[model samples]
Target: MQGILVSILVGLCTGVGALPFLFIKKVPQALKDGLLGFASGIMVFASSFNLIQPALKDGNLLSVIGGIIIGTMILTFIEHLIPHTHTKNYDENDDSSVLKKNILLAIAVAIHNVPEGFAIGVGYGTGNVSTGLSLALAIGVQNIPEGLVVAAPLIEGGYPRGKALLFSFLTGIGEPIAAAIGFFAARLTDKLLPFILSIAAGAMFYVVSHELIPESHCNNNEMLATYGFIIGLILMIIFRTVIGE
Candidate 1:
């Protein structure tokens, strides 16, 4: 119960992060690319350290590998089923293009939040309130930057500030939902947690490679993107160090 409530608060941090955009009118293109790159870097770090590494420790290599493959395949299938355009030739004025882009971004963010919620749920499931709260705090802190990542693109794509913030918050709502699932199903899913985590990592890897990174580089802001990526990784490192794993 406590975990579920904390998960909701963690999810709201995404909206809190986007609050700045409400006052600021415009975001530079280079900055947008950098933000996207930052998002990619954070996702990559989370996938590798927070998900895959822990999975590897908890399960066999073969099973973990299999889970990753399955995860990638699942995301690939979803991508095909969804009708969305890449950022290469984005047209902000084109209503169809804007809608498609926002949809894809929202979906990617929601999927990314699932594993994070699971971690929170499992932490609480261990009967350690401190551990659960710690995980919640770390994730919540990280979520602030992610809010910017989501809102920036939407605003750039011509979404109203209120709509962009709403969308960003909506994407994060998945975390609490997944946390609820994880909390209730923890005992039943214990043996499968490693595979589940690996699957999430794979899904995130696909999102970074196929979605965020490409979009970040689309504007020829590769240098800014690269710098943003480094800073993002560093931020994650600092958070992990300060938060204690």
Candidate 2:
């Protein structure tokens, strides 16, 4: 129960990080896309290098592949069903429906948050507070841009200050929900944890390579995108090292 509360606090705190965007002016398209790519890279590295590789050491390759396929398919279908709201940095100018884009992005973040929170819960369940906190902090740190990703476009779309923040905050709720589910269900078992990590890795990798990188490059800002990716990677490395995970 204590662990669950901690997980919830961690998840909620992540959402709160979005509050800063409301006060800032709209970010440039190139910068936004670039940062999105950077966030994508961070997620990719964390999920792949940290989560999936470790999982693969203990889990079956076939199961890991299956999990990735299923996770990818699941995200694909959801994205298809939901309307996509491109970021402010879709190009020099973006004219897509902001509401639709925000909703889709929110759904994606929400869905992604679930597994992340779950990973934290599972860590605690295994009696590893440091591991759980590390995971939560990593995800939380990763989510700051995710919050920006949700709000920046909405601000472009003409959403009011409070509403944009509110929506961004709402999208972030998936983290704790994931934690609760993971803690209660005990899904992150020794046998199953690796597969679950792989699923998240595949889903995140697809998002970064397919969605974020492509979008960032659409603005022809390769340098900016690369910088963001490198920065994100470095930050993750530092966090991993400090956390000892």
Candidate 3:
């Protein structure tokens, strides 16, 4: 129950992040790329330090490796199966293009949130309050940028602010659902915890490499994206240090 509540709060951070879009009518391309980059960096750190490292410590190498492979495959399969728009030529004037891109972004973000929710669930299910809280905190913070990533393009593409924000918030709804599943699964089998953790990490890695990084660097905002990534990384490091202390 507590875990689910925490997961809900973490998931809602996506909506919270989108709150800024209410007042701002247009989002700059550079800012959008930077937000995406920031999200990528946060996910990378969470995947490494929060998920995979801990899994390695708690479970065997084989399980961890297998989980990672399975996780990556799952995401790959979803990407291939889903019919969403993907293109480098994003013309804000083209309503069709904008709609397709927004759909794609929403799908990607929703998919990414599942593993994050699972991580949170696994942490709490393992009876580690600190672990659960840390995962929630990291994911929650990262979700802000993710929300912006979802809402910005829609707004730029001429979608109403209310609709953009709704879409962004809706994409995060998957997290709580996945969190419930993870919590139950973790409670059922302690032996699978590490593998599950690794799976979540792998999924996040896929999102960063396949979705976030590419999107961030696509529009000649590579420098801003890179800096955003660096800032996110540093922020995570600081968070970890403070938490450790």
Candidate 4:
């Protein structure tokens, strides 16, 4: 019960992040690049250490590899079926295009969030609420930047502040929902934990490599972005050490 509550509270950080955009007029491109790079680093670290490494410990190498490959393929299928564009290309004059890009990014973030929620749920389902709380706390803190990532661009692209924040909030709702589902799923198939974890890591890897990295380095602040990535990577490690089991 406590674990579930913590997860919801952590998820709420998404809204906290959007609160800043409500008062700000414009988001600098360098800041955006740095934020994106930070996110990418966190993703890479979490996917590799927190997720995939555990799978390697518990599951056969082949199964873990297969899970990763299949996960990547699933995201690839989504990419083709629904195109995603950066905030830059779409003109503010074209409301439809701007909205489309916003929606796409929202969906992408939502998809990426599912596995994280599941991991939290799995922690609770496994009767380790302490670890779940730690994981949720880390995710919640990370979601702050994600909220900025989601809402800032929409503001720049012409969406009303309230509407942009709403969209960002929507992306976060996926976490609690997925958390519930993950708890149930984990209880039913505890033995399959490693495979499931591996798959989620793979999906995250795809997101970082395909979306976050390119977006961060797309502009002139490439070095700043790299520095941001290092900081994020270190943060993730520290997060795991301090709060995680």
Best by lDDT: 3
lDDT preference between candidates 3 and 4, better one: 3
lDDT of 4: 0.75
Query: Between which residue pairs do clashes occur in model 3?
Result: none
* Model 2 TM-score, all chains together: 0.81
Per residue, candidate 4 scores C-alpha lDDT tens digits across 18-115 of 88886795778798788888877877876687667767887889878987897799778878887787656767678787778778887877776776
lDDT of 3 at 83: 49
**Tens-digit lDDT string for candidate 3 (1-245):** 78889889888888887898878877677887888788778788877887788788989999999999998998899888884544476676778877887888788888788888988887788787777777888889888888887887777777788988888888888888888887887788778989988888888888888888888888899999999999989988888888871
Q: What digit string (tens of lDDT, one per residue) describes model 1 on residues 61-96? A: 987899889878977887777645566766877888
lDDT scores of the candidates, listed in order:
0.75, 0.68, 0.83, 0.75
Q: If both were scored by lDDT, which would come out higher, candidate 1 or candidate 2?
A: 1
- The residue pairs found clashing in candidate 4 are none
Once fitted onto the true fold, the runs of candidate 4 whose alpha carbons sit more than 4 angstroms away are 1-3, 88-96
Q: Which stretches of candidate 3 lie over 4 Å from their true place?
A: 83-93
List TM-scores for all candidates, in order. Answer: 0.81, 0.81, 0.93, 0.86
Candidate 2, residues 1-245: lDDT per residue as tens digits?
75577766665654575676656857776776667666766776667755567667778889789878876886787677864534543343435544555677777777667666766665555455675666666666667777776777677677787887787777767666667766654445677776666666566666666666765776668788888888888887887787775
Considering lDDT, where higher is better, how would the candidates rank from best to worst? 3, 4, 1, 2
